[model samples]
Target: MRGFLHLGCVYAHGVKNVIHVMLENRAFDTVFGFLNHTTDIENLVGKDPICNYVNVNDPTSAKACTSPNLPSKSQYDPDHQYYATTNEIYGTNDPNVPLPPVAPMSGFVQQASIGALKGAPIQDLQQVMASFDPANIPIQATLAKEFTIFDKWFAAIPGPTQPNRVSAHCATSNGWYDNSKIIFGNNCRSIFEDLADAGLTWKAYYQENPPSIDCLSNLRFSSNIQSYSNFLSDAKSGNLPSYTFLEPKYGNLPQNKNTYTDGHSGSSSFANAEAFIKQIYETLRASPQWSSSLLLITYDEHGGFHDHVPPPKAPNPDGITVNDPNHPGVVYSFDRLGLRVPVTLISPWVPKGQVIHEPNGPQSDSQFSHASIPATLRSIFKLTSPALTKRESWSGNFESYLLDTPRTDCPTTLPSVVQF
Candidate 1:
């Protein structure tokens, strides 16, 4: 990555560099649904009392429902792992329970209580159903309002963070569905490798500790990974690579709300995440590359939160399924997509208030998944290498959404971030 390479990529749009900010667990409805309450955006509007999930312990009892601005403490992280997600989607994690014609999308409270089980204590089960008001995370809501936001963006897989993030980079997870700490050295081919192979410079700027990007062997030995601090200086100087993927801080968090940047429920605050995102947006806005740079902000998965949208069937990247002897359960086919998550496109090329529910391909029927991150990069940079997997080839990307002309009136500064 240390040479004067040929600029082989064509000018498809005004964008010369792309920055993708992939954050942690939170449902699209939990975060962006406030728009529906105030505007006509397809979200949890009018459903003031969002889904009243059944109390398994007592059928006559009413459990958690969606409330604005985090009505109470997010007791636990809300059990967004494999089996819990299954219960959250299908209303039962029991393998015997057949997939319904329509996903029940009705087990958040149950899953949060004891996961897939029939009888469980309903202690603080409201965390999974709690939605964020626009005032809670003003930065994200403002960006969605001022720029372009995709309503049908789903996570790449119907599982945890690691697998979906792997799909975000590798275009497939090599059949891993859960976030096992032992997933290192799996040798998953990533977009960073593809960029390096194509001689297009790229960097993965991370905060504090290493992110799930370290799950791939290629990035383990890569020098392209740098601290989040470099992101600020690099953006200030506008000396960014062709592609940049930013990862927020994860694990071992301090008590300070202003620095809780990861945005994961129960662990970090929305205001803290807003502070982090505000810096990135404002820095990029003032950078020399602002006019030619496009920023994409999204999450990894829904984290077992309540999203009413039933995920559509997804095209399998590879014909692979989970096979773990230690954890024997339903063998996941990786065919269905995870819950909806917010994906916003911030750039001078995007039309304000634009909402693309489906991919703007020739058919324009398929919705976007996390794999579209690499798929869009491959399409934009015009990489020579073949797609990492079939899913990348079929991934609904944002290549067609970019305008040929860049707008001169793009905002130079974002709205004020929420503070404690």
Candidate 2:
């Protein structure tokens, strides 16, 4: 394992570190918390709650990618571009059928505006609460029937894979914006660097293996990272980093047993990701580290899931112009913005149903940027490297997810390692 340590005097003396596991391509669309269409749930209720969670392919019929605005040089019509560039992977619009108006923000918002309320009459909580009969419901039912917790969700961005992943990590795309160049530039520091400099040990674990392991011949930092299967070796040898990342092998098969080899996106799979995550949670929660450690479960990005909110403006270094905010001579900064993938922070400290409503955006103090995952690690460990933890404020404080009073004994029961 590659260790990151800051020997400078500014560091805090000692801290029991953290491990970050980034589960790539898992989305809230698959989670139980929220669903774009509630009607889809009427049939699944009273069944296994796990049935509520589904893979992207389950809703593939409704999977539609939209492009808000595309540059003219790209292969799309700005006025009638029904689908974005990435949507081309599946199919393009026929054009003979006139494109509908830009996708509406919300079905509720649209229905109420147009005076066409269907399904149930839901004006407020009282109406919704009275409508459901609890007598027939199971006591173990975990999801809320009706609740409103607000947070930032992405609206207009459209793409398939790598661009969305890069946007979530750095908050800006280096312009490769698509999977065609997933291996482009690597000169910049990631949220991981920020935490490492702060004296935290972080690790990226892949179910089958690590990412970018074979392509080290191009950019640097190749040897710095390791695979997920090797985590046990690192832990036994005391080389465990503060944060850990897990990448899936595109399909369900293990990396070595593949008879067919597609590119990175094709070769990587998720068939065993859910089981792997559960195992990791069980190991940590059963150990003495449950209270102090935090686990962030989020998708790399939305694989064209429909979210009703618009992408908010963010501070960008490579200024791109966006008309909504109306800032002159400034390029659109994606730092604090992008589409919403399901982000769930799992730890003993994270209260069940505790929704963080960061008013400004994810990068705001109220909201946490994905980068905040590393920021909290840096603050907790007190590594003093500026470059690595430069964007700490934009991220969240992982400490908030810990218990106010330290635990003398470990938790008696662990949360069922759940996947949707």
TM-score of each: 0.90, 0.56
User: TM-score of model 2 relative to the true fold?
Assistant: 0.56
**Runs of candidate 1 exceeding 4 Å displacement:** 1-12, 36-40, 56-59, 71-73, 115-123, 181-183, 253-258, 324-329, 362-365
Write out the backbone clash pairs for model 1. none
For model 2, the stretches where C-alpha displacement exceeds 4 angstroms are: 1-15, 33-160, 167-171, 196-199, 209-224, 233-239, 252-271, 317-336, 359-366, 387-401, 406-420
Q: Give the alpha-carbon lDDT of every model.
A: 0.77, 0.37
- Candidate 1 residue-wise lDDT, 24-75, digit = tens: 8888888887774236467877766766456544657767777775642343
For residues 1-420, write the lDDT of model 2, one tens digit per residue: 212223232432233545544444322322322332233332223343221001122433222222221110111101101133222112222333332334222221122212221222223101100111222111111212221212343312244455444433444444433354545443445555565455555555555433532222222354546665576565445455666665545433554533211112122222234345455555665555555555555555443333333344344424543432233443323343434545545555445444544433223333344545544555566655542323334433434434454434333333342221
User: Model 1 Cα displacement at 151 (Å)?
Assistant: 0.6
RMSD values, in order shown = 5.5, 12.7
Once model 1 is optimally superposed onto the true structure by TM-score, how far is the C-alpha of residue 282 displaced, in angstroms? 0.5
Best by lDDT: 1
